[model samples]
Target: MRRLGTFLLGVMLLAGPAFAAPLAVLVEERARSDYADSLPPEGAFEITVKEPPKGEVLTLAEFWMDPRSGKFLANAVLETGDVQRIGGLALITLPVPVPTRRLLPDEIIMEDDLTVMRLPVGRVGAYVETEIEEVIGKQVRRVLTPGRPIQAQSIIHPLVISRGDRVEISFSDGLLALRSPGRALSDAHEGQEVRIVNLISNKTVTGIATGAGTVEIVQ
Candidate 1:
């Protein structure tokens, strides 16, 4: 048994680069450089080392990538002055915007109400928001949990004019200005088109909501 154990130890020592921490780091750096344009400012890549290169590990001299296959190729210079070809598979991670705290329905989202988190690209849903700017100042449509990615449909622009509210519809062409009383037929955010029913004419018209209770007729 002692001799068998000794033989196993010898074989293990003969195996090069038992731990591939350096190789993992080098692969991550290559991913960062290759995916720089697609990554957000605070975004980063997470590399999972599935297969570590086998050789007398020394230093990674060169690195390149095959983005389509999510594979990385590299050259490791061994102590024997020989270059060893190495390859690895990695999973890329992406950044997404999330709420910083539990947000109640209809609550307005402020800049401080949100945070950013990284998730495996496969874990991010198609409708999840990835940019913070897309969420800030928006109204929460449903409850949001802390550190969880917010779905695109869960947040919306704050409504400036609500349905059934009295609004003033204004039309102006520099030389002429006119205002008409109307009732909002639909809810709308500032600068969004809203359906309004003219109080005097008893007809519905679409206009852009310019402010609180104010709709502008573009033409």
Candidate 2:
């Protein structure tokens, strides 16, 4: 590993005439990369080149320095392809949505439960939540730690109506509207069909659960 870094540095120093003067450089590479699909081999060399070829982007470049010296300086690379000397503590972080408080399993999610904050990008997953609407009203599928990134699979559409619950059955056609007290024969969520028992007529009917404690007759 050391030999490869040294070889890269030697090649980079020879990139242009500006770095021809004998000098030593220290460098570090980001091991993680951002991508939605297939990610290419993780690499993009950023070396201290006094003057890289103007208007031309360098690809497959390398940087290295002699290891004989006991002293080495710390440095960081910026998004604009600039090698900067790190003189003090630089907290590298990435923006991501995280839970404001610890969330227990099966807890209904609310907009106030989450907040966007900066975290180490490497520790965040590709499917981390990015918007408030994504998690709002969702049911927590697993326990979530406070201030930790919320993943897509951590929440789900909650079952609005559970089994054996009383519900208002609504039937409508044209200008006619009728409502009857009914009991849910099976658990269901919004927009899902459930078997309902009309309490007044004592007859079973299938309807779509439309809201809290409510269902619409299919017919």
Candidate 3:
């Protein structure tokens, strides 16, 4: 086993250059609103770099705009110990609008002079830099693509649950009783679902409810 481990380590070292280089492609946008406002609001402007040349990892950095003009300057470091060459760059532009709201008199008075004057009116923008690499080890070769629009539904789960409800709990063979303290629980019903949370690992599992205050985890 030790010999096998050493062999694997040697192989990894030999392939380090090809695998260690970071070539990340990221999507960035600016919103002209306060934290209380909804994020990624409709019609918000966005800028994207669809495809960036792959290179060894060095330093990836970005700078914010002057706020007066929606422009950003980006820079990157390559594994070849040289800065990225300027050219063959692809950029994507999206136009988004900002919404207006009433600000409290106190809020207006507490603003910083620099930020207050540069406050975004209807549009904002950002620049992003990422270190990424091509996916490897898979049977099929896949091109590395970034800035793909992520569907909102992908991260959302459909469940009907409300706060402060009396609920039951059941496990593999034993039934445990617990109360809901007005928190997020997936849609479940009596004698229909079972849920378990592993506090140590912060993992949750769902199963079936067999009876009142009793749940049966379908292993």
Please give the CA lDDT of all the candidate structures: 0.77, 0.61, 0.32
Best by lDDT: 1
Q: Taking the tens digit of each residue's C-alpha lDDT, what string does model 2 give over 110-171?
A: 87888877654455568877666778888888898988888888887787777899999999
Model 3 scores worst on lDDT over the 10 consecutive residues at 129-138
Residue-level lDDT of model 1, residues 1-219, one tens digit each, is 234334443554598543434666666776778776765555455665545545444455677887655677766654444556777666667778878899998899998997777876766778988888889989988899998889999988999999999999999999999999999999999999999999999999999999999999997
RMSD of each: 7.8, 10.1, 22.6
- Writing each residue's lDDT as its tens digit, candidate 3 over 53-145 gives 356434433323333344444444444434443222212233321113322211211111111112132323342111011111111112212
Candidate 2: Cα lDDT at 201: 99
Which regions of candidate 3 are displaced past 4 Å? 1-40, 43-45, 48-59, 85-219
Predicted model with the maximum TM-score: 1
Greater-TM-score candidate between 1 and 2: 1
Q: What is the lDDT of residue 216 in candidate 1?
A: 98
Evaluated against the true structure, the overall lDDT of model 2 is 0.61
